[model samples]
Target: MEFRATGADEPANDGRYAWAGTKEGHLFEVDTVELCIVSSRLNVHLSPVVGIYRVGRSMVTLEESGKVLIWGTFDSPDAPQLAGTFKSQRVPDKQNFYAIVGNELWTSSGPVTKPGSSAVSMRSPQIRVYDPTTTGSFSVLPRPMTTPESVGHVGAVTASAIVPSQDHLVYLGHDNGFVSVWDRKTYACLFVQRVSPYMITSLVGVGKNLWAGFRTGLIYVYDVRSEPWTVTKAWKAHKETVLKIVVDPASLWTDETLQVASMGSDMAIHLWDGLLRDDWLDAELNLRQPDFCTFRSIRTLCISWNIDASKPQDLSGTPQNLDFLRDVMLSTESPDIISFGFQEMIDLEDKKLTAKSMLLGKKKGDSKFSDGISSSYRLWHDKLVQAVRLVMPPECPYTVVHVGDMIGLFSCIFVKSSESATLRDVAKITVKTGMGGRHGNKGAILARFVIDDTSLCFINCHLAAGQSHRRQRDHDLVDILEDKSAFSGLGSSSPGAYAPGGDGTTVFDHELCILSGDLNYRIDARRDNVIAASMDGTFETLLPYDQLLKGLATNQTFRLRSFKEPVITFAPTYKYDPGTDSYDSSAKKRIPAWCDRILYRPSDELANSLIPPSGADREDKITPLPQQYRRWEVNVSDHRPISSSFDMQVKSIGAAKRALVWEEIESAWFGVESAMIAEARDYYGGG
Candidate 1:
C-alpha cells in the first residue's frame, strides 16, 4: 500500500509516532524510536483506503468503500478512538479525500470503468461539512465547489491538495489533464484548464502555485492569482508512473533549490531541483544527456545536499557532513539545449559492440514528430542510464540494466561487472511455426553476450503484429529461428550477429544468463482465439518466460488506453490504415498495435535474493483505466517500452567475477540504433 509522513517529528525520548495506512484496511502506528512497526489494527472495512489526514489530535481516513473513519482523540486525556464514520451518497467509490476545517471532508471518485470507453464517470465530488462535536454526523454541503453545469463535462477530479494559506481554500488539479480550480467557500469552479489528457496523479501546493503531477511523470505548476492560472513550470522529471510528490517549504525561502521527491512504478525515486521557468529552456535542457559534464541526473542532484548546511565541513567537500536541510530555492535558469547519444550493439562473433547514435526518423517536414521522438528518447535514455550508473553502482553487491525503445522494439542488455565485463547475445535460434515465402523469414536477436566464466546475454525480439498480418509476422519470426541449420547459408550475418557455434553444436545453452525483448502481441490476428480472449495477452502466455527464467517482467502488459490525452503523435507500427488518422496519405500506410516489451531472467541466487515472488502484474491493480479506441492520439509509438533488472553477483560464478568489471560501455546503445531504421508511416496531418 501507501505511506504518508505526518507533520509530527520522528518519535524520540518523546512518544510521537509516524502513521501509515494500507489498502487492506489497516492503520499502523510506526515508532521512529525503534524503527519498527509498533502497532497495527485492522479496524476499518476491507476496502482500500484512499487517504488519511490529521484533524487536531484525531486521525481521519477515507476508504474506497465510500466510508470515512474519524479516529483518534475526542477528549484530552483519553487515547484516540473511532469517533465517527461518514458515508457519501452521491459518489460511492471514494477515489480520494482531503481535510479542510476540522470535521469537514472533501472527497473525489473517478474510478476507471471497463476498457474501450472514453466517457469517464465525472462524479462531482462532494464536500461534507460535519460537526463532530455533536452527533458526529456530516451534512453534505448543498452547494458543491464545482457545479453540475461547470464540472459536467470535466473528467473526475483525480487529485486535490490544501493551499498553504489559512484563510482561503483553493483546489487545483486535473480531471484528465484539465486543470480546474474551485472556491471552497462558495463551492464554485473558478476556472478550467486542460494541460494534458493524462490523469493528474498528485498535487502539491508550493508557495502561491500548485504543482500538478501527471501519470506520464510530467509536473505542471499553476498560479491561482493569475487570470488564466498560468503554467509557471512543467518538466518530464520521472521515467515512469509518478506516484507521490513531496515539497520542502524551507527551500523556497532559501532561494537555493526547489526540491521535489517523486516516486514511480519503475521502482525509482527521483528528486528535481532548479525549476526551468521557460518552456523552451526546459525542453532544451531535457534534450541533452543529463550526466554530461558537471551535471548529474535530476535524481542524484536532488539527494546530494546533506539536508543541513551549518554542520562542520568534511574533507571530501560533500553534503554528508552538513546539517539536514529539506528544502532549497530556485533562482536563475538555463536555456534549452539539444544533445544526442548513441546505442551500440556488439556482435559477439566479431567481438565488437558498435555505437549507434540516438536520432529521430521523420518524413522531413514534421516538427512535432521530430521533437517528440528525438527529445523524448533522449530524455528517457539519459535518465535511465544515469540512474543505473549512480543508484546501482558497480561497487554495490549486484546490479542489472534493462533498456528498450518506445516504438515496439526491445532489448535486454545485461552487464555483470565485478572485476571485468562480459557481454552475451541471444538472438532467436528457432521458431515454432511454418515458413512461407522470402518475406516470411524474419529474425530477432533475443540477446547478446561475451560468455566467459561470467556470462551475460542480451535478447532482443519483437513479437508478431496484432492485426490480420500477425500470423505472417509471427510465422516468419519463428521460421527463421527454426531453420537454425540453414542460417549459416542465408547470409544472415549482419553487423549485429554473433558467429555460428565455432564448435559446431549449433545451439548455445549452458548456465546461460539472460536479457530478453518480448513484443507482447496485443494486436496479432493469427491467433484469433487468443487475441479475442485477451486483447492484453493472457497472464498464462506472459508468465512462461518469467517462470522458466526465474525473473520478473517490468510493465503491465495491458494498459487502459487513453487515460491521458494524446502526447506522442506517431502511427501504430503494426496496424496501418491509409485513410485513418495514423496513416499519412503521402507516406506508406502502417498498422497500429501495442507490442513491445522487456523481461529479465536472473541467476538463481539473484532471483531468491531480490525479485519478488509471483509473476502477476501488480501495476494494473494500482491504476485502472477506462477503454477507448482512438488511434495515434498520444503515444510516441503505440507500444510503450518495458525493462527489468537482475543481480550481477548471481549471474557470475566463483572464477568469473574478477575479469568482467570494466568493459567499454555505450549508454544509449539500443535506442540510438533503432532511430536509424527507415520511417514506418506518418499518420499525423502534416507529418
Candidate 2:
C-alpha cells in the first residue's frame, strides 16, 4: 500500500532502523535494509506530526498542535511505549517547526524579548531556546538573542542548523534571501550575507560546508570555517522549491565527498554530490579530455531590434529598403543558424492591456491572449520565416527550431534543415522582471539546445528603462542567470542530471551563450552632444561614456563582465525619429545610445584555443569568431536594428567517442578510490 510520510529520522547510533510519522497520526518502525514496516501503531498523536527528531536514546515526534511525544528506548522494539509528553513553549513558526540542537529544542521568536530595551521592530527576528528533557515542566533559557537588523528586513526564519564540524556556529536561512551565521555559545550574529533574490528554503551544516537550498530549486554550498565565508559551489539541484535537505551519515564518515538528498515541491527527491572534493575534479578532467572529439564550423547570424509596436507590413518603405527583413537576412551570407529578437513588440504604455494580457497568457500554453497582445509576435514570426524562404535557395531549406515570447519581448531561432536532427534537449523559458517579476512588460526569453554534442543558448532581454536605471538592468541580468526552473514537459530528471555531452539547464550551462536585446543602458552624456556625436560619425569617441561598455571593461557585474562584445563601428542605435535619419525631437529627447546590441560568452575550450593540445586534434576545439557587427537604419521604430554574425564551432561526431572515454575514466577512478580507502583503513587501524 502507498503511504505519505510527513516526518522521519534515523537514530545517530543505529543505521538498521528508521522512525517515521504520517499525516494520519500513525507511527512506523521501518527496517532500512528490507524497506518494509517492521511495526506500526495508529493514533500516536491527536494532530499530524510535522517533525521527528532523535534525542539521546529516545525518539520524539512533534505534532501540529505544538505537542511533542517521547518514546521509550528502542533496544527491545515492542511497539514503542510512550515515555512522556510535553507542549513546546515557544513562538510558532509558519511551518510549525522545531529543530534539535543536541538535547535542546529550538523554535523561532519575535523581536524585543528583553525588558526596558527599545521596542525594536519585528524586522529583527530571533530563535528561541527550550529544554524538552524534563517532561511536564517548563525549562527555558534566558532572553533569546536577536538577529542582526543589517537590512530593512531579515524575514522569518525558514530553516536553522548548528554546524556538525564546528559546534560553536549556528546558521539560519531566511525568507528574504539572506543567510546569517551566529555564535552558538554567545548567540551573537557573526555574519550576514544575501546569497540570492529568491527565498532560502532549507539549510544543512555538514563538515566545513553549509548547503542552502533556494525556492528556485538551486543549491549553494558555503565554506564557513574561515572568517568571511565564501560560496564554494552553486548549481541547480531541483525543478521546484526545496522543502528539506539531509546528508547521509555514512557518506560523511569518509571526510571527503558528501551525499546529499533534497525534497522539492515538484513531488520528487534528488541526490547530489553536495561537495566536490579534489578526487571528483580529477575524475571530471579525465572524462572531458577532448581527445576523441570532432568539430564542425557553422556561421550564425543574430539580429535584434526595439520595434516600438510596429507590424511587419509597416517594415516596407523607400525603394532602397523596400523589404527590411529580406535586406537584413541577405546582409549575412549563408548562415547555418539565424536568430531574430525583438523588444517592445507591443505598446507598453497601455497598462491595463499589458496586465490583462500577462494574466491570460499564463493559462494558454504559449498562445496569444484574448486581446491580441501577442499578435505582433505571430506576424513577425511568419514574416521572418517567409523572408528566410525567399532569400535562401530551395535546396538548402531552413526550419524553425524554436520561438519564445514574453509579452513585449520575442525570440525565434532557425537552422538549416539538414542540421535539425542534430538538436537535442531543446528548451525555451521566459523570465519576468517587471514590477518585481509580477509582470512581463520588461523581461527575457531564452532558448537553449544541444547542436550535436555542443550546447548553445540564446537570450533576448528587455531590461528596465530610463538612463538612471543602470543598476536595475544589472539586477535584471542576474535574475535571468539565476533562474533554474526546469523547462516544462522535459520531465523531472532532465534538469541538473548527468547526461552525455554537457547536458543541463541554466544559461551558463551551455558552451556558447549569446545575449541580444534592447538592454536599455544609456550613454552618460547630454542629449545634444550624444546626438551630435552620432551624426558626426565620431561614435568611437563616445565609447568611454557607454554604461554597458564601462561595466564590461571594469568587470563591475559578476556574470555580464565575462562576456565579450564586438568593437562598435556604427553610430548609436537608439532614440531616432520614425522614418527619419534625425535623432529624437520629442519632449523626452532620449539620448542616443547603443541600446540594441549583442554579446557572447564562449566556453573555456574556446578561451584556451591558443595553446596546443596534448594529443587531441587542434581542430576539435570550438573557437567562436565574430565576423560582422553593424546596425541598419530601418526607422520604423525609435531604435535602429542591430545585427552580428559569428563563425562558431560545433561538435559533430563525438558523443559515442566521449562516452567510451568516460567508461574508462570511471573504472580507473573507482579502482584508485578503492585502493586508497583500503590503505588508509589499514594505516588508521579501522575497518
lDDT per residue for candidate 2 within 429-516, as digits (tens), equals 8888998888888889988877765667788999999999998887798777766223433313332122222235556456677899
| Model 1 TM-score, all chains together | 0.37
Candidate 2: residue 28 lDDT (0-100): 77
Candidate 1 residue-wise lDDT, 1-687, digit = tens:
323223233222223465677778777777666799766667565677666665544566666776766564444233343323433322345445444442455654443454678875434544334433333345566433443555455666666665453226656455555656666566566666555546778876654566767776655555555443444544454656677776644344344434567787678887755232223232222233122212111000111000000111111233321211111101101101001111111111121111111133234664222443344444434443454444443453222333333222322232334422433332323222212332211234332333332223333443343344543543343232222212122113221121111111121221222222334344322333333323443523432332111111332111111011112122222332322223222243332333433333322111111112244232210110112111212122222222222222212122232222111112233243233111111110111
lDDT at 88 for candidate 1?
30
Per-prediction TM-score to the true structure, in the order listed: 0.37, 0.69
TM-score (C-alpha) between model 2 and the true structure: 0.69
- Sum up the clashes in candidate 1: 69
User: Residue 443: error of model 1 in Å?
Assistant: 25
Each candidate structure's count of clashing pairs: 69, 0
